[model samples]
Target: MQGEATGGTQTLADLQHWTWVLGRAQQMLLENGIHTMEAAPLSGWSDPSAFARASADFWTDTMKLWQRFLDPDSEGGAGEGEPAEHARDKRFRAPQWRQEPLFDFIRQSYFLIADHILKGVDALPGIDPRQKEQIRFATKSFVDAMSPSNFAATNPLVIERIMETRGENLLKGLQNMLSDMSKGQLTQTDANAFTLGENIAATPGKVVHRTPLYELIHYAPTTPTVAKTPLIIFPPWINRYYILDLSPEKSFVKWAVDQGLSVFVVSWKSADATMGGIGWDDYVEKGQIDAIDTVRNLLKVDSVSVIGYCVAGTALAATLAVLAARGEAAKVASATFFTAQVDFAHSGDLSLFVDDEQLAMIESLNTDGYLDGRFMAATFNLLRGRDLIWSYVTNNYLLGEEYAPFDLLHWNADVTNLPGQWHVDYLRDLYRDNLLVRPGAMRIAGVPIDLSSVKTPAYVQAGREDHIAPPESVWKMTHHLSGPLRFVLAGSGHIAGVVNPPDAQKYQFWTNPGETGSLEAFKVGAKETKGSWWPDWRAWIAAYSGEDVKANGARVPGRGNRKTYGDAPGSYVRQR
Candidate 1:
């Protein structure tokens, strides 16, 4: 009969009347627990304000009832003719409904409630609930189902305390998330405030070095120190270098100096429209390689033990590969990668954001030659949207809370742009294509990358919770490398995994005996221990340094009367 309505024999007026009735009936059924699940989506509005206005008890009960309805075991987990373990089976059948008198009453009450709303809006005629015992029982059951859970597993008391303290914790969480979205739009840093002058007369023995790309700065050993080979540190370009040298007490660089190790850090140049033409190779050539030349020339050293953190470490690996292919691997004495990705093929959750469609959209807009830093930040925040976006929306907008200005928050806001071609090529080739690990899959400056040829002794760190690069993804690099590899699985995410201070409690890492042939064998031989990997890394790096030198090494000629090349912290950082 419904299919025949298409024919002209069925009058258009009758069809319209049927459509109205059906629509109203659906509204009644959906708004109330009729044939559908015990709980349903809120009607009329779907925004946060509507959610806030909703009765707390009503929502709590609705969620609980929905949870139970979804669990098959709640209905014996099986119907007649179903196997004993049917609930665990993928094709398990649901238990049949009993359709008792109480069910009929709830169905009628649902229609009545929906009718009230429709009539109030002049859409339908309202119905009054009958004073029936079954109807009253159904109504009470519905209310009981929706009421907040008091079970210890649910921890309703703790939840209430958090709600009270955090000011509608859910709402506050949402507001913080929205605020993060807005803050992500801006690409300014409130963390890169310290200037060389601030540290300039503070320590006389400190050697402040500046690179063509970055003002390469460091503290040199004043007294006689072990011939510990010069250690060059590389931090991710996504963030400022100070993350490694955060502060006096937490500074990894300061700790290295105390360990009697000579350290030079490649503080990457902040990118701008001028750097739009620069690609991955250019960063290697003008950035890492350039820093190496400057340090060697100034320190008068033949080779340095290089340490690269996160993205910088990946770049270092590429540079080393390029150098090795050209028979120039002797420049590096040893190498250490901190939570870096040489092979991004196994990058789990992050893989979702780098598909073909997203790559195309990014390339089209990045035609300006650079992928704006803000866009990258926004993309990362979206990965954890519930925490970074919705949480803020609930807090600030719904609950009216003040935003906290944390240093990490400020630093997070400081995003740097990536050159268009380079960024796209990296995603498509390394991430989407998994070319880096494939033998000779990548070419740098006309040089093919063969990890087997890279015989540089290496130390690789993998963060357990790192979303950007998982432990497995980074550990995969060891298979491709021909050299001795020591891979450590560290605690924390991408940032904390690398920037970990020496004394941070609860931090742990696993180190195998030597470069245990493969990642699997490495995991077996691995031993877990507490405390940051900073001290362990420092000890490992110190052993790689050649014996102490008698003569003072190369030194950058002082500018003396010449105008300082650039202002403190320089003009390049502000280009964006």
Candidate 2:
């Protein structure tokens, strides 16, 4: 169950076997300095007493688990909850995990030991907070890898499969592992299932503008009428912007256009060795500001509405801050942030890499002037290792099953490197020093970027379950922005929460129209709505956006003297 029906652990049932599987599927991912927490010495524990108590409890739980294995009907084996009732661990969902006394014991004992060790890790003192976080993250990875469900002997479902396939599954799994090794990356989705501009980034459009840093994609309008103020999205240079235009049914760009708006998206050029000299300022000037001004020229509109998803949202805040410093705050009529973090004080797991020591190590990753994209992709995968990693280990490698086509996973496997200096500047200034939200603490484009100085009307969306950009960190934007703002909480995490479409109606969002003292206070007073936040955003942005005109009007950006560079989902995105 480890979320992705990954098969068994290749008939081996030990830490080393699963570690090999984990390392195989997730090689080159943990090369970043943050994942390199030194194993804590067994003697030098910060809390010796706590460790002693935990060991005692672990043994007590182990003995009690044996009792429950002998008599599984008994209640409270270790501390609480039945094996099947685990809220997070889904690997033991098979009936054999519960019905077979030994498997049940293995499952319960595993959780007990994992929790015990983690509790001990949490209690470890005298370590740097960031180091502690790294240790915790590393510990969790080890614990997750060691789950019995990852082992063929312990996993009844896998044993059943091995028996059914006459051990063909293992052979097939080995071949699959070899294939992934050859590619030097795990195949998270069927490679042949989707194609760019064919099935995925299929929105009809042309690349109206291009820069070395990014391409401005002007999407074809769906409706006859278009907003007087065109909209441009500054997507995180971290991934493809096609996330907003993945497919017609799930495409936020298409949906926005149907609502009578001209939408332009920034397709950032993937960084490589040649792009090493580019820093944060290049993204601000050539990336955001250039794209904003280009859309304005094409549409002949003075003010353009903007949406920044994730890191781009952070960059948008900087762009706005720079504009405010230049007394050009009116350039952007409205701003929308999808899980962007301007304040890293409460940022999630990714923030663990912001330490001074880690910053240097990460900057050293610049092999040709940029950190490799594989580093970013792997780091994110580890953030949700159980689902993104170990599950695939069993399903694709050990279990010998091919994962079906998934647009999201395909996009995820698509890696993008960060400009070396830019990556260092972002983590050091914005994350390590927590400078972005502090007025004048950080300078961008030769100007002090003060988030509060940008008085544009804003709509901020955060995910309740987002780990990459925690709601608490995002909510701090409420206090940072000086403008009238609406904070909306979505039901899912980083990607799903933001990419949610209205038609699917798959997840819900919460709206607290007014400002609150904190994220928790906002949630307490928030009204939960059972649908996508797209419409809610449309209503907020529509007010700022001027009257709609015919989609074919001369005001629209076109194949005119502006020069149609190429089709949307341009050549840059096609760069590996």
Candidate 3:
């Protein structure tokens, strides 16, 4: 039997209510710098046939859905299987969506419309890649905003919650909304459930070195014997370093220390007006390279193994190039990149936001000031709106409940500001121009930096599903380095892939069996490993790590010249 809508008066009221709520979703996009002005689509069709096909498909799908709505039992849509989308899209899996014909139609119709818009954008022809990206972003933003799951009346879950709580859930939701309004971020996890040093960034260590822009933490060795060469980790400044050091089980920092390596984490300071003028050279010199020198000096070693995570890996590649230029490339014993992209040619969705118009707009907003972490976080959240934005909207606000404690999500929320000039210069030079891949096309610290010149052996890894740095983008690193290169792919997205520990036995990883020239070739010849890549990395890195030395009482080695500023996870990470 078909589900019926309420009376005419109730219908009108619902129309007004939903209009206001959806209008708020659009408002959110606006607040996050996705202007509705850009959301206005192209005025003319450059390719008539592509759009013609889209229109035909759209009509065909619409008619099919209409037929299904009229006679749900009719032989239509995979014949008794839930709409193919149900298995894939988690948003409409609720029983009420299928049990009620009216909602079933709404759910199916929304998917059809979303698919039409996105696929239409994909099919749109003759538009330059950049322009097409902008249009696609605009259309996708619109489509994501108009999702039936966003509105109260349209979302059966919200209706179910409202009924169960005797309408008190609505009031609670309103209160949550107002609180989020004041706080200026959508709540993803319980903030109070975590404390930085105690539970999350809890790896025991000391801030052995400090600079205006970063704090270098030296973790005590967990084993009785340690590697002769120290390990310096340069995590992307966009996020705090704690991501690699989440809980003991998930903490890559802890795991590495347990593997008999002396680990040092660089906790970047959240940039502000004073640091706004700081550029890429300043970060490479004072941040990445400085940490290297400090660790080398403390450990009294000629060189150290270095790891860069995410964009920090890009910076490290540049720094290594600079070192190669300065005849100091040998200072770094080995280089490892975690889901990092040195070549931006195949960089994923993140590259979409670094175009000229967007960069100019960002510059205009910055005015020689730092890019706020919240702004960056907002943009990142929009990249996966269904998981990061819409899901939270449904779960927290609509369901009128608090989010569960999640350390990774909390670390994700703890974003760091990008220095203004550094932010613009690199995005323009590396991301937009794709200069990092081209030898001598980019420079750092007054040196013509070339990645290939830095003939240091490298281990580059990418998450198979990473949106920020696609596997193809990371694969291009094999071409950039002059020395030995080992590339690997891990399952899951950016953070999960890298943070995975061996004990968990969670996700799988892949390694090229033989000579791997490209991502596809690697996949074709790859051998799959059953668990985390940490152990594999440990085995790979062991060759580079020097002969083991007896552990020096679980203390940092030879810090004669460097002062111990404080305990591990220093104050820089504590900044918003």
- Pairwise lDDT winner, candidates 1 and 2: 2
Which ranking of candidates, highest lDDT first? 3, 2, 1
- All candidates' lDDT scores? 0.59, 0.79, 0.79
Task: For each of the candidates, give the backbone clash count.
Answer: 27, 5, 1
Q: After TM-score superposition, what is the CA distance of residue 130 in candidate 3 from its true location, in Å? A: 2.6
Candidate 3, residue 413: Cα displacement in angstroms equals 1.1
What TM-score does candidate 3 reach? 0.90
124 Cα displacement, candidate 3 (Å): 2.5
- Candidate of highest lDDT: 3
Worst 10 residues of 3 by lDDT: 1-10
Error of 1 at 409 (Å): 2.9
lDDT of the structure predicted as candidate 2: 0.79
lDDT of 3 by residue, 1-64 (tens): 0123311122334434433443344335333322322464445644435544655676676667
Off by over 4 Å in 2: 1-47, 72-88, 126-128, 555-559
Candidate 1 ranges beyond 4 A from true positions = 1-212, 220-228, 514-521, 549-575
Q: What is residue 307's positional error in candidate 3, in angstroms? A: 0.3
lDDT of 2 by residue, 421-533 (tens): 88888888877788888887877888987788889999999998998999999998888889889899999999999889887877899988665798888888999999898
